[model samples]
Target chain A: MQGKTGSESWQEVWDKSVNGPRALIDCWQEIPCDPCQEACAQGSIVLSSGICAPPALHAETCNGCGKCVAICPGMAIFLVDRSIGSGLARVTVPYEMRDEIRLGGEAWAVDGEGNYLAEGRITRVSGAGRPGRTMLLTIEVPEEWALKVRGVRGRRKLLEEPEEVEAIEAVEDFAFCRCEEIDYSRLREIITQGEFRSLPALRRFSRAGLGYCQGRFCQSILRSQFLADCPEEDREVESFRVRAPVRPVKLSRLGGEDG
Target chain B: MAFNNFRILQHPVLGEKKNGKEVRIFLDGLPIHAVEGEPIAAALYAAGVRITRLSPHKKEPRGAFCMIGRCTECCMIVDGEPNVRTCRTMVRDGMRVETPRGWME
Candidate 1:
């Protein structure tokens, strides 16, 4: 049979087409990952270049195959059919929790940060992986929230009750630079000094990210505070940590000698 | 302890599926063996290397979490650098290692 013709709708592609799916994958991270590229059987998704590039769809050409949604490593992609007319969007997303959620269960829809914003109903559920690990959960979310709700919390933590965002201790006491052994107090002192009013100056002086792990640990926290100190460089400073062999091992391991 | 008593003798999920070369590496001056290709955190966890880095504040203990790089709980100093995520990085042979303490500069 010939592949999906250009005349078919996205729903027809969802029902019968095997080439591409109408999915919106929200890549909240710029991390190095590319499972989605390998997942597409129809060549519907094109991320053939770098792993960090967003997966793009040829709107007139895609046939709605759901492979990309199931294989995304970050669980950041989703299939949506917003043209269904009731202001209801049928969303197909990856679920990684081991909870016992029933069909039609009401899920507290959340953003990437797990913050609850709206509610959604489970429409369809199927195990999405080879080992039957992750679930490809299809939910009926309000069209307004279709772009907002990236995930759902199946297992509610006890500490998730609504609490005001206040830190009992000043942010300074919280250590952002574990390598520099710079606690919030020391960081505060460094910030208080007229010579160092921002994170770059602090990073330069204390060598905050110059440790072994290459700032994979405290860079985000430091960046947050750094942006707070100097908002002018916020966008540039939010750049991600350049990934290396971020893990630590002994020199003997890389020696290539049979150990 | 007998070899079978190890927690990673073969984990039900991650352990048995790991098919890599077994190699030895040193941690904080002690020789420890780890499976090649797996992240340094799994090897360290198998070898019981807790305290990847000391807290810059009150000096509390921290280890691996969000085994992926999303959570920064597993950062340590390897060789002469700092802030390494032990989970994302694959173990190579003979890499210098260290637990990041504070202010290397």
Candidate 2:
């Protein structure tokens, strides 16, 4: 229809489907994506203005068809139908892997922070469409985990279990202080203790702020933790410490040809 | 007989780039100028400086392996700093460097 937004098309989908429950398009990222809208047969999933706009689901009329869940390129959408009883929500999501994982298999659920939650059952598994690239799996999880549980696990599977795949995300490992071998935990502990109030004091007590990496990793963590623990303390530490000769060198480079 | 190919320069995704810098520095008081900004080990190889450091427990001659800094074979004392990661850290101008003999000073 003329001047119709995705909300309008999704409203039509709600009318067509039975018990159309509204599902929040949980993909919070600001990126261009709209496959879910096209995937819906009933026109329930809508991203009409632009791909960057968040997808909206007509909860009351959404038939739990699981089309939007499977077709989301960013995998940001989840079909949450909580009306299934005992706070148990049914979640339909996409699975990409060469391994033939079956339905009703026990899957571990975890949150965004890598915290382990309740394990759920794989209620349904189906590979649809040409080439069968995406496997749509229905999972029955507690209402709490419905928001968090993203993927499952498989043994030596080429397609890493969704949860595992997200976990291995390439966050740069903190260049731990090598001199005294102090890490994030040690820094946290030192900050929590009132004795060493600031980064300079913590460096004095433990060689945390010092070392070749020069507090690139622990500086921010230490500063925030220190501030969080002791708000009244006015220990202002420079956010970035610039160590002289930012790069390390070898002894041989200084001396010449006389071996 | 070669068993495992443990070479620092040979990486799958990254290749050794020619670091363009010519300057002199001393390693344990020996005259050498490694390519500035290249790994201390790579520059050492280019300048024919072997025996980066002696192992802590083994006391054996160790060179750079696993240039990604997982292996501590290339750890050495540089400008009075011990256990310096030569592989990961780049070379600088007029840097005073030394091969670490053991764990202690």
Candidate 3:
């Protein structure tokens, strides 16, 4: 829960539950989607404020069916069973990763940001009853960690930090027009020095967008960079002129020559 | 074969890519083996042909920046066609690909 929608929300879900176990839909984003509501047979999950609302879970109605877990496009739903034992609990999450976690096998429990938590045993790996591709991985962790542990290490090591590399000096050193090999530094220099008044003039002078791509990639970047420095009143950026034979056609084919 | 360092052996979500029919494409007249229907840019990258074209103005080496068809950075002459978006175009048997010298050329 290091990401948005902290463990407090999950704790709220647990506190509201009446039965043995319930589905905790941790879908934080208010994206317009409602497959989870339609998937639930018991009507436990409901998006009361239209599709662009986070799902409201009726914990009392949810029977840990794990239907929402399979149907959720984001795979944000999980079934948490705190009544499994005194200190241990079962946390069932949707796993789509290629690596497999065998039933009863030891797995390193990981939080939302993939930080290492307590080690847990893979209680179940159920893809049989699931509608689509995601496999339900039921890992039994400490009751305290049930709400915290979101994912498990499946044949892959967890919390391996990436090697640090030296940062580039200027932001302009990064290529802007990849086809023409134009960098931000060059563009900045062109704009600040007032060599070219407009984008068309700059395009002609530097040949930035005239390369193989024909201004498809660098046109937008050029406009943004130009507008950043220029006054808002005269910030009208023009798009590059698109010529015919837009699709690259073979010269031999155009000449009606057969191979 | 030597340039397979960038090739993804296995993806966590996508899994292994099941290659199609094996085909040989000529890159600057050098035979490079590739899977048919794969993007010509991917085939080229697999064979280590990164710099597809030189800039018309500065004559600087340019390779694939955006792997998608949107960026024409990976444009190369394919089957006698200049400025072909290799990242979008799929490879075929005996396909002839050439790196354009410069834009005006």
Q: Say which candidate scores most in lDDT.
A: 3
Task: In model 2, state the lDDT of residue A188.
Answer: 61
Q: Clashing residue pairs in candidate 3, if any? A: none
Local accuracy of candidate 3 as per-residue lDDT tens digits, B1-105: 664566776665555657667899999899998887889988888887788888766778878878887777788889987778888889999999998877576
Give the CAPRI rating of model 1: incorrect
Q: Give the range where candidate 2 chain B is weakest over 10 consecutive residues by summed lDDT.
A: B1-10
Could you give the candidate ranking by lDDT, starting with the highest? 3, 1, 2
The digit string of per-residue lDDT tens for model 2 on A33-72 reads 7777788777766664778876666554456677776677
State residue A78's C-alpha deviation in candidate 2, in Å: 7.6
How does each model score on TM-score? Answer: 0.41, 0.38, 0.81
Query: Cα RMSD to native, each candidate?
Result: 11.0, 13.2, 4.7
Alpha carbon lDDT at A37, candidate 1: 61
Q: Give fnat (model 2).
A: 0.00
Candidate 1: regions farther than 4 A off: A1-21, A28-31, A128-132, A154-259, B1-105
Instruction: Return the lDDT, model 2, position B63.
Output: 75
Sorted on TM-score, best first, the list reads 3, 1, 2
Question: Residue-wise lDDT of candidate 3 within A1-259, one digit each (tens)?
Answer: 0111324356655764324667877776778999988998988777767898777777666788898897788888888887766688888888876565789989878888887777889988887333346788888888877777778786475355788999988654766676666777887787777755578888887777876667876788787887786756266666677777776566787899973
For model 3, the superposed segments whose C-alpha errors exceed 4 Å read A1-19, A128-132, A158-186, A195-197, A250-259, B2-19, B28-30, B47-49, B54-60, B68-70, B79-82, B99-105
